[model samples]
Target: MWKVVVESKNQEQIRHLVFVDGINGRIRLHFDMVETSLRRKVYDNYNNPALGLPGYGPVRVEGGAATGVRDVDLAYEYMGDFYYFFKNNFNRDSYDGRGAELVATVRYCESYDDCPYDNDFWSSTKRQIVLGDGTVTDDCVGHELGHAVTDYTAGLCYFMQSGAINESYSDIWGEFIDLTNGKGNDSSSYRWYLFEDDKYGASRNMANPNIFEQPQRMTDYYYYCGIGDNGGVHINSGVGNKAAYLITDGGYFNGYSVRGLGLTKAAQIYYETLTHLLVSGSDYLDLYHALYQACMNLIGRFGITQNDCENVRYATLATEMNRTSTYCVYPKAPICDVGEPVDIFYDDVEGKEYWKLTPVTMLVLPKYLYSSEYARSGKYSLYGENLDVLSDFAISMKKGVSLPVGSALYFHFEHAYDFESEGSTMYDGGIVEYSIDGGRTWYDAGPMIINNGYDGVIYTGAGNPLSGRYAYTGTSFGFTSSRLNISSLAGRNVKFRFRIGNDEAYADDGWYIDNVRIYMCQVKIVDLTGYWVSVKQTCGRTSRCTIKGKFVVQNTGTSNSSAFKIRFYLSNDTIFSSDDLFLKEYSIKSLKSNTSKAISFNVKLTSGLNAAMRHVIAVVDADNVVNETNENNNLLPSVPFL
Candidate 1:
């Protein structure tokens, strides 16, 4: 007779048997190790798909004891840890923000030893975690689970900047969970490497992106323009990963110094950014805006302070993601090249070939040919002097040229003119006019004034007049007109005319226009340079060192730098963070043309000394306070100090 013993509700169990055909007796092969408190279920795929595989209440609750299934047990333990991490820290139940049952399938594929695949992933479609044999670790599991979290919120697209941001979020959460789950080195209070052991070493280093040749700043951004790696999603993810590191650890990245807000707050801020702020196709710059907003939200709700918000901006700047800089110069692109020089005064010695002028009365002014003469790169200039009374005088291009469509016509010339103050002259000025028609009805193209000083009389209201040169003064003064955009006459047959007249009240050395030529507008750009930090012992003894450092910044481009920042810190890590022991911030109110400033700062560390190691780091324009031509040289780290 078979024994009939009913089990108690508290001791729920599963029973399975191993048998040999009649020759051998049946033996109990598996039993359940059930924990009612856990809402998670882990299943062994047994080197096969778990779909439609036999008995089911909970796949993990199937015929299995804790002793026999190593992979299943490991998966179950890690899943439970993830659940607690979210529940305890974020005040959430599961990846979906609800008490959803967590499901995982381990030992996936046909055979554990024979299967070629070696990976784990979270399938939002399957709504479950899938793992290959020997591919289980806290980082791995956490990374996959983080994908599930991202799926529930943000729904970030899997390509371009959005995709990179998604990958970075997963890495961040994986590291976060790994560190929180008693799996990282606590002495350092941070672990930058993710999947350190599983991938045969650290798979990615968050502290520095250079380990994998990933760009840390937008200046070095990778543009896998071709189709591959999902637009270099995983490769470019290092940029955002470095951003997370800067936020949590606090340091200088790019040119900005991020304040260390600690992991807990950092996680909260990121959680809010992912859940409430980020959109599907958000790029790096978009992410920067979201993070900046998140920091402000923290300040309004959690009293985080304005400095924290500034840190967020700085961090975003270091990533070269912030597109806002008051000092940045954006030169317009040119659509045409330099055509044949159009000389109106026969100044080129070959000018008569292209010009045929009809004027009422005009005189040729030959500037003193000495090197000291401020002529417009020529020996001759057009001078209009009306000693009698206000008279109509004009100079026009004899031929017309057809401007291509979508192209811009720029007029480049140098001029100097003097004017006399007249009480009755309503507007004392010279005009530059252009005609699409062959000299028919003319349109006043406005002043021919240069800094020889005539512009004030033309611009100053109704009756105010000037008695000085229109632009600069003296025989040495000369003025050059910027590339004047003439896109209006594009696709039209056009010619330019210069007209200057004098009033009856008084006469002065008239308008002298020279070296007039039309060409393309060259793009103007700022080349930010300097911010090199040189260290010297300012005062104090060793161990309690007071080191003074000077940061030098210069404007090497045609454009000027209106503002900039110089950030300095003393720390152990290569990247600057808010959590570093010592740091200082300084700004250049204004840096002008071809000039440099040496900003000095002192670092004093007396207490909580490492006594063994430290690094003095100085970052120029850390916030990318201004657009620059070269960002690679901004960081200067002195030798490690004791």
Candidate 2:
């Protein structure tokens, strides 16, 4: 016998139907029309009173089996869990902090495709959550919502170390909410696993990430550096996940001991770091500092103690998050000496220094401008070749230089090029361009050339990308030096690049550039120092004191100074401030570099002034009428009057 059952429910009516087939012991079921409705409670942005009113109704359904209702129910339940967790703990209204509406679409499938979608993600552009079937577990819901919080706050870029941190944050919050939500499994055995209840088994182990092929420490061999998974965004997140786990539960791993601060304090510290301290480009080392700083900032509030901060440091060390050698370190500004002609930037092209090669056309395989033996001064020079017709290549400095103040700056390089040329018209050539606004817009720098200027303008036709622009075309016969007066870019940060283009008809040896340098002229400063040789005080008739002193001035700069005045003050401290009492103003003649002059001063102090309570301070170039490279060293240390 075969049995069939049908059940339906509504506010006004409830019905049940059962059929058993007696003939041939077979049963078949069919339905002409079936309808389902859902009435859900909707809450305001604030979610103030914790209870919502019934509002939304009638979910459309057509034809397909209703196998995804359970997933939808789980999504709603866990989303509510995420909302209450952040709201009660962090006082956050919503993901955006201003009560942005939380939108989620479950059982999502791409357009024009019928395959079962198996991934979940937060659409930053659409500002919503999308989940495939069977993926709406508690941690999964929390994980995607955490991304929204990150978007509105730190907005961490999703690449490299920053991207890894971004992924780890989602995992951290997801697991935290799952453990504390009071609805999911909170047992110790199940506490550290993400997606533990999902049908696909566990996705990651926060406490032991190595089991799932994730690097728990930075120095691990599994630490990914390849150009996959968005620079190993998912795989490298294991380091951060392990750090979070150690901070919360405490452990002796990787030779460092951490005392557990439990989930509350750990969450607070990580939340503060993510929302307040970290920027979009923050990496692992930056994260360590941010975590420690957040811990310190939370002291005296939220019951955070100094011991918790110590654990934070130990956890970061245990995870090797403070190491920079294992990953691509963020570029820092080159330090420059005061008056030296420092090469602010130089690329021999023997290996990658600062310039990055980019191909504008896909006409050739392995289209990279490489470092080759076509050297001018070094063993290797940046070389670009037109391997295929209609190809364009460029090599640009990835980092910018902050030109020194009060110095003449110049751009120097040696290059050789050979392009397809006919008479005075060049069909293929190279050009130089620069950008001051962080590579957003580039301007032709040919006008600033001071030596070995452009050879000719590229022909306006023949499918050359650099057509109609003055460039370095034709053969240089040998490597030649080029200089550009870039003093106008002083005090501003700038980046530069060289680009070469070829026509569809012909190609030749492209370009070779070496020994690139951005430098400045030797800076000169009129640095001055002063000292008091003698001070004699004598009392006058009306309780006034006559003070006499011998003062000396010395110029230590490389440049001679014009006539300048010196001012003496009576200060209680070594440093001079405006509140100090002015004693005398003395004039000095022009002093050559490295020369000294001594003068005697006689001045009667007023009756109210006490010479015994002050020290004598001398300041040269007091009005700042003369420019100096080191203006801070113009003040004398100070001498006692007695």
Candidate 3:
């Protein structure tokens, strides 16, 4: 017999209280919610007269006769428990047409109060995801539900490239479900339109993933999101999502036929690829392998051709596909990781320790054009407090040259602190402050202070600073606004200070900030069209000189409205070299469509000449190129020639 059960517990520990609801076929869910909340707590479910809303905080789903007709009386239930029962206990053969038995637990406690539904995944268990109340947008509910579905339908085996594909699947299907069920709009609704108003609206956009995206390649479905839940599953999924978009509808500039690949076809292809073809963390090359198989399977005995796998071919040519014969390199880096990494050190002053703070950056440019944006923006960022602080977050900011008086900007945020077991108060400076006066003075513009991550600050630099906040002091303040507006501030050489006064910028005993952002007051045109003019590999007088030429930049984009300033630079292999090597910069702005303009950049043979030849590579810009000032953990000592 199946039922909809809702039970009461101590509200401190995870407990199960199940009941049956056969009369209604509704699978009622309930659990004991802990007193601990991400930012706020569920005091009680007393009816309120203010808005006639039941409790002060979020509530449990009130069922028919199961709980009561009232909505207050919040209960504790979690996503893990429901997933757990569904996976282990709830089976199709066991069903009797009654309401399904889906048990769950409420939030226990976590290292960080991530976004609303942002679960830290202290560890992936069959029971709970262990979230700390981050900003789990309503979209997340279905996203998580999609995970449950993948867990069951796909046999829950963690497919790598397929994982991103699976994620896109969720976003696609979830958004589809939302629109189909009257929650949002369907094809009639623009993928750019917001369906759910005043709530965590919209899920995915099949039309354009680039809409509301931070960078050129990613989609609004996921990219540049704060890393609170399961190692950025949402953020990185755009890679596969774009594939889905292109598969459904032809690409914008990908120069491939994505028209014929609609939802029916996409779902068929992805389901096969995820469930049967790919493995977890199957690098780009691996994706080439897996998808090739998926395409074959999809065509079956009928037939297939090169045109069908054109996207797959393009992916191969674009891969940074470096594979070692043996999986053993010097100091082995983990197989699967997200984004470029930067170490964030935190020091302890008041006998408390700030664990870790990692920063991730997401910069958007025009599609297929890199150098043009790099030069047009004259983009340079200034960051301090790298000395030793727990404050490290990928700061995202939009640049705008025009603005009325009122414009909006938002920063996605989450507080990563529980502090009780660690005997800390989640660190002070619970606020983030923003400055429009180029860092001279800063005023709080984001949300008020709270312990959990649910309180994402939305501050407009409209006339004020902007949507920016970070922890200033634990008790007195919640979070300070670190986001800023860019209407009149755009290209004005603005300055920003993330952490406020009196607090250790990045101390061991402080809170960690992730997904920091600054947005434009209005949409601005961005063009990043540029390519390597031509690659030249020459051996200077020294053997090292040869390597230098192999690594130097030659040609870039041809000049056009979207121009690229070719600032070529070179660096010495001297982690311990006697002298220094600083690659210089130059400009070449000639960008035209459908062409790889020849950009010539020469290498300088420093006095320390040819002996110390390490390695060389020429990229469009400096983001991927590393040198002296830029501290990267992956840099290694020059391997002396055998």
Candidate 4:
């Protein structure tokens, strides 16, 4: 028998439908509601009169069949769609992925007059999402549920930059689902707009945020330093929202262009990024790395082409969060499980023993670029200013270190130079040189190559009389030096210098250098394995059962594991490294060489297990705590049952 049930609230009521078994006395399908006003007043005192409406309370309504009520039906339909989106599309079990109940409260108190007297939020404490009557739109419902997905996955923090990413990810989910479901087909209206039916107009527009007074690029970012709105989380989220739009539909912004690969491919990249690459404290640049990692994963997992990867790259590059980037020995370092970097030396002109300044007769102003107070590193930086025609000046650094096999030297430094702009071979620009004999002789390493033109201040020596009517317009902005191969110079005293001069007239802004560092590779090796054992039952009527098992990982390298994280995943299908279902992560603390540890987890089967079909993979050093000789061997799967 089917019946409709109505429940009471403050001066109103909601209705829902369910089926009741005539013989079994069981009820199926329930729509529950809670009056948040009552919960909030009991938990956080009741105050009315001053700013707005009446008190709120909790109520539950159920029915045996369709009630045809608008809000209740809308909530139930939206929730079902959202659940199906995750389960059918991504194989996610539920919000928590373990069958957590979907609890939502409708008719939340509409008292506060600011924006959403009608509002909604996903309460981590309540373990349920809530919606207000005024804010009950399809996209808003999806947006709030997205918070639940993010909570179970990356669990990004709720404040500051991380909070902004959290918000943007939710918005991305809403738009992706709508477009995928064919609800956002209106080209001009709903493509980038969100929450159209709300009391206020669309809260955010992803394609172009300028209409909403939001900053879509890092340069136009709004950083709220005050103690309100959790550091402008909703405001700063436009950066990531715009990135999503560009990734899905391709557009040009801020001097950067991206190719749109459509929403299907874009959603795959974002899902992987949110689930695998992000952590609680990740910021904007971290999102770029996460998206890059996702793009690389798409190449192997989804048969994505190089053009698809480039689209994702340019999409992230438009966000302007690439504010600080370093050219590593391997440009694709972020996409793979890269080796660990071992710092050799770092000097920012704070010390003087390693580097020496050689000035010529006409004078070489080799000192800190700016005053120590204004220097980039809060300390003096290496500065070289030689305006003398035919003058020669250089700053050299000599240091000796043991370089391991297969390790490349990563020389990272920032610089700014403005030299003679006219000639094909302008002699006024600086050249990096390597020397073996202290300072007696040197070989030209290469011209300092600046890939992206400098954006910082370009100083031309206009005040000097020698610089009259001639301002060298050539400027190379701050960038890292090429990966200078120190393999041949390994195990010996290595020296490098920067030299700049001119044939006749010298017009230059001089080179300002700071935050210099050299890095080598460190190696870590880990062996991983997993196994399960089952016991037989005694009687003939017995059904076989399998026991939950554990995976073991060991440090097989010469050095310790150094507190790296190891992951164990279970999959019935083909196990692709990190693309499989994540089971658990364990932190191994300094496992000395030849040491092993085991992690046990829960698993059960109704019948005898075909261990040969099922796979358990252990990923050691999951976060790349230490570089290893073989990145491919980090993942080890259990052998088939014999």
TM-score to true structure, per model? 0.44, 0.51, 0.31, 0.44
Go through the candidates in order and give the clash count of each: 23, 0, 100, 11
Model 4 lDDT per residue over 1-642, tens place: 666465655323244455676677689666644222211110100222232221233222322233354555555556666766776556565677665656555555435463234567888877766666556666777788899898888777565566788899888887766665555244666677888756666878889876676668766634333224655678778888989999889989777788898877787888898888876545677788788788888785555667888878888888775553222111211211245667777776666556766653346444443323112343465666645455556677756444455665555565545465444334355656676665567766643222222222212342222232222224542212234445565654556776655445656556666666666755455543223342222212455434355566666666665667877665565464546667567787777777677677654444643444556666777888665555666777664433
Q: Which stretches of candidate 3 lie over 4 Å from their true place?
A: 1-139, 150-169, 179-183, 192-207, 214-232, 300-642
The number of the candidate with the highest TM-score is 2
Q: Judged by lDDT, which candidate is best?
A: 2
lDDT of 4 at 383: 67
Q: Give the TM-score of candidate 3.
A: 0.31
What lDDT does candidate 3 reach at residue 141?
Answer: 36
Encode model 3's per-residue lDDT on 446-538: one tens digit a residue: 342222222323122211111243333322111111322233433344333243222232332233333233332232222332323233444
Worst 10 residues of 4 by lDDT: 36-45
**Model 1: residues with Cα > 4 Å off, grouped in runs:** 1-38, 48-68, 110-116, 184-190, 221-225, 300-303, 323-642
Of 1 and 3, which scores higher on lDDT?
1
Ranking by TM-score: 2, 4, 1, 3
